[model samples]
Target: MSKYWNEEIECMSREDMKKLQSERLVTQVKHVYENVPYYKKLMDEKGVTPDDINGIEDLHKLPFLTKADLREAYPYGLLAKPLSDCVRIQSTSGTTGKRVVAFYTQNDIDIWENCCARAIVAAGGTKDDVCQVCYGYGLFTGGPGLNGGSHKVGCLTLPMSSGNTERQIQFMMDLKSTILCCTPSYAAYIGESLKEMGYKPEDNKLKAGIFGAEPWTEEMRREIEKSLGIKAYDIYGLTETSGPGVSFECEEQTGMHINEDHFIAEIIDPKTGEVLPEGSKGELVFTSITKEAFPLLRYRTRDICVLTREKCSCGRTLVKMSKPMGRSDDMMIIRGVNVFPSQIETVLIEQGYSPNYLIEVDRVNNTDTLDISVEMNAEQFSDTIKDIQKKEAELVAAIKTMLGINPKVHLVSPKSIARSEGKAVRVIDKRKLH
Candidate 1:
């Protein structure tokens, strides 16, 4: 565990990468066999042992860990280290059952900082810049992870963990923070707050923003950048995969590059659990080959995405995954038609409407009905209410062509919708029983 942290592993060659992963994988399996009862029982049931997982090629033989497995184990059941050795813990919001808590040793914290540092650097962040972390800190993974990474990057880090948009803007002005990190919804909310406070974007002197923890479209990115007058970059990760620095978008803005050396990423079919080749859309699976405190094997992330092996001009050897559209659980089924809220955002933005929209689904007379509410910018509000009604009608027709279903569309004033600081709750499916 003391030997888990490595900072100078950035320039590892392909062969070096294989050797490092192979060595760490075996060592981790042995550690799990000795210290973790859950993994040991799983191995015994499969009639396999640490000796069988000798290298990366033998990964297929090990039992895959999933959300269900974590749930069955509950809290502290998968720790391969002693409680005295563990320093920190982070849990997923679960929302369905007991939270999935991940234990971390000091070594785990150091490696997380290294990964976050890579993400910051990829987004053109430098030591000269001041980092303002806006993601919520305790229990959630985004804030503290980026805070540590920004500190390690030799920058003046502001641990302003989310909320209080007005105060966040004030600190941004007073401290002159150049780098901002938070969820996309928060960024958009802060943008609206800035406008409400009559603050000019040019006055804050922010240069770049690293946004993650929720899925967002490029249209939303453009809106955030335009509102804040800064370059907005995407950082992708989950608590199951070491949080915010698992993948990151470079200056090219093409896609997020997965840090393949620390964690091996694969896209597999959600239903069949069969690995799909590069460029095929599937669920993202991660194998924490280098983790010590909680090294998850073939962990199903349930994120639908595609990967590309083609080398990018950024010079990073990591593989790139497309921005996730939606989670498999988050997918909507309406009258035998599959729909994603992202598709609605795409249509709204393409038609020159604000990206802020909400979907409401209800069952009446045994038929599901969907209603969408979109906020109309002040620029679109002119003359009278009739004009707004006419525009709303046009948008309703536009959505019909897009979604192939006529969804009741309503237009509301700008800033009238509920602002989300972290994750946005867009859909209200009354038909789905809790």
Candidate 2:
């Protein structure tokens, strides 16, 4: 039998799940329309009202909320509860223009933690397991979200925030941590560090890892798993949607399952805003049906991927989202061809190159130039210049086949590329600078 934090909810029939979602969505729509003036104004302008949305079926009628809307609303415009009622707040990293702040009441926190607990349980975590959470803490949601979920699972929780890699490994070895939680890039770096420390995968006690907070390729996943000798599961969420527990990967490893009981998901054409049929690739949208302090109705997530109801071996009835193809904002147009960083990473890993690389896009004489600097494997370094050139040529050929664009591949020495303790900065688009 498959194990789950909430078996009934996870395995609920489609009919029952839809009914539950319908009821919660109606209540949530009414709550937002009544409490949030900013959303109320949006509804008024769109000629939509809470009564118009009787259930999830009417969700598309609601005005969609975008990052631009959140920025315009700023701190308090979208808040559905009073400050006194809210117990906590989490903000986005603000690497971009403005940081998005989301509030959570005690009840909201409870529901969010419950969603996270389902993720932990789905990743083979239990009260007996030691969960070491290393996704940054404080204003960022990743650390706190997973930390609370670990507690909910009754695991021996280690609230070790991100960074201090050497210490992260020490705790993992000393406590025999069974579940590792952090960004996929950090996990990859940790795997590299373990080898440097003369520790084999078997020397550590980690059985599974829940990695997220950034996009990672399946090739990168396999690399981390082989290095750490553990299955690396992907978790997905954003601060707007109440952190990292909105969805999680089950043992199937095919895709991440959305917590449909708490949130309703949809796919829409990014440009046309038309909802697509199942299995169609488009922008992933979400509606929080159970949040109290901050409720977002039909929020555009900008992640490009497909949703599938196809039978999964894990037996979770929740809809599964393919690993995101790319964020709409992150997809670049190079010489009239669309390119995603993930596409480049996929080619690199397939060519036996390290995931560490830099993509530089620039306009020269009105023509877009794509140049990638890839870190060479120390073991594969050839002494002869001709051999090195041959290696670069081979990579260029492989990338061309994958991306349909010719890129200049420059091979640098191993470990020359700076390692990222957080989300790796892989792209430097000089075209934007011009």
Candidate 3:
């Protein structure tokens, strides 16, 4: 079996990759500057024109775009192609604000699917495999992206858009699904559900899982891998960047390889917005070079991570990005300290608690308070309040040691926390910060 879906491009030399990126980026910039008035305005303000950007080296000259810019543009402000040319529109969950609607031309869709197919292939997917896609469909990009890619790979795709866990498992067993795609949290939930349904990790035919759409910890990754008896690979993307195929993990299991031919990845100092050197952990930024309908240049992803050009065992020369540590916007400041949900999650998983947990932040008596409600596995659940308190105290200490800020820990019953087939709600901040 071929190890790569597009070996020619995936393993292209750095010089060739940069040349391709430069060419596409030049054309894309002209297209956006000519068609998208909002971005043109941004560029004009920055005194940058298409003539200024010759190649990837000049990418730093482009102005940055943020979620705020997308919201300001709303439905069609940043569209480069006409609605007639756009074949589809995939959107964000709108949980943060106005849903970011991304237009896709048929060519755009083809390239996006090709990117996804690369991800599936990296996860060891082949035409003979049954690829089950459970990401939420409709406006959300997860379902459609993987679904298209599965078809491209000639896998018998199960477009079982997220939810209905029982039906998902039934299909998994009946059809003998070889690859599963969904959010990491949902994958964990499915793992927990399989155990409850009297199925061992190896009972099903699943050999691999491609999980993304939400931030997850390494500990959670190992847990899911053990529960499903499959190598759980991480895929990363946003609706703004045409969904979960912008980058994907390979057998190396180190970091996701960004599809650099389609998108240029950069790390920037979050506060100053200066592009950081390679290996520096900072805010992640992307510039879509080939996207026709809605190409975003220098779009700030708010994700904190590093990028490395280090050669890989997989032989793909594409740049690899560390799994995002946390989003700049998602970072919580409590008691004059910065805390990320992933840090808390790491502590929970290490402490042998269920990955399903809730973090609630609030202010009382003019002081910020942090409380974490962690679900206890069946074996750990006890009727004794003192035992529970002791466990909670231990967890508090562990978390404090990790985060440097003490958090009130509440151990709750297994299955008490609401299960989500979509992105799991991890934090609920009640503080009013204007």
Candidate 4:
């Protein structure tokens, strides 16, 4: 039987779910317009008022909030409640630009954890299960969000932050952790380490894994599943919208079910800013109806995906979002051709290579150069220079066939590329530096 943490809400009829969302959205809009001057200014500039938003249908009329807006707001610009009311704050890694800090009241934390608990339950988690979380702790939402959810599910929680691979494996063996939570890349690395230690796939007790905070291909999913002897599940969330439980995969892994009662999702044309109908692939937009501290209305997520209302076998009426094909911002335009890292990753896995690879793009003599360095699996590594050159040529041809752009492929030593404990850094655009 498929288990659910909140079946009543998850399986609610579409009419009833919309009713609930409409009510919460009305109240939330009023709350923000009254308390958040920054957002109020945005509404004023757009000539939109709290009264203008009658329900979810009016959500499209509101202006979208982007990452640039968050940076402009900085610490207090988007906060809807006073600091005293907020019990916690989580922040983005800020590797790209200024760190975006998100505040959460006690109520906000409770709701966020409940959303994550639903994900855990959907992934076959129970109070009797031991959950091991390897996502980074403090500031980052992945660790704290899943940690709280594990507690809500009454599971024996291991708050192991990322790093110390040997120690992480030891705890998994000693405590018999049944559920593993971490980034898909780190999970892949752990699987490699386990095999290196001579531990078979069945040597551990983990049955399922919740991997997120980064984009991963379906080929990588099967790799992790075979290497770890566990079913891999994807969880989606952002620090701006209360972390890793905004949506999650159920028993049926076709797509992740968005928690509709708490959030309203829309697919919008990235260039035109027009709302697209269901099944149209475009940028994702979200409105947090239940958030109290930092409620974002029509936040632009920049993720390219499609939403489907098709009925699911899990019996959850929540709408499902297809795995994000790629980010609009991450798409690389080289030689007048668009290329995404995911396309390269898919080809790599299909050609019997590890998922670890780095892409470098630069402009030399005003001509764009595309170079890719892929980590060769130890089992496939060749000591002979001729053999290794042959391998690189073969991979370059495969990638060219997929991307329609010839790339210079260099096969690096196994594990030579730095592994990411959080989100992997795959692209190096030296053109920006120049």
Please, what is the whole-model Cα lDDT of each candidate in the order they appear? 0.82, 0.92, 0.94, 0.93
Off by over 4 Å in 1: 1-8, 382-390
The best candidate in terms of lDDT: 3
Among all candidates shown, the one with the greatest TM-score = 3
lDDT of 1 by residue, 11-79 (tens): 356677778788888987888889889988888999889888878778767777789999888777887
lDDT of 4 at 382: 63
TM-score of each: 0.92, 0.97, 0.98, 0.97
Worst 10 residues of 3 by lDDT: 326-335
Order of quality (lDDT) = 3, 4, 2, 1
Give the per-residue lDDT digits (tens) of candidate 2, residues 1-434: 23899999999999999999999999999999999999999999999988898888898898899999999999999999999999999999886789999999999999888888999999999999999999899998989999999999999999999999999999999999999999998999999999999999999999999999888999999999999999999999999989998999999999999999999999999999999999999999999999998899889999999999998899899999999987766688898899999999999999898899999999999899999999998787978999999999999998899889999999998888888887788888888643
Model 1, residue 179: distance off in Å is 0.3
- How many clashing pairs per prediction, in order? 0, 0, 0, 0
Pairs that clash in candidate 1: none
RMSD of each: 3.4, 1.4, 1.0, 1.5
| Candidate 3 lDDT score at position 73 | 94
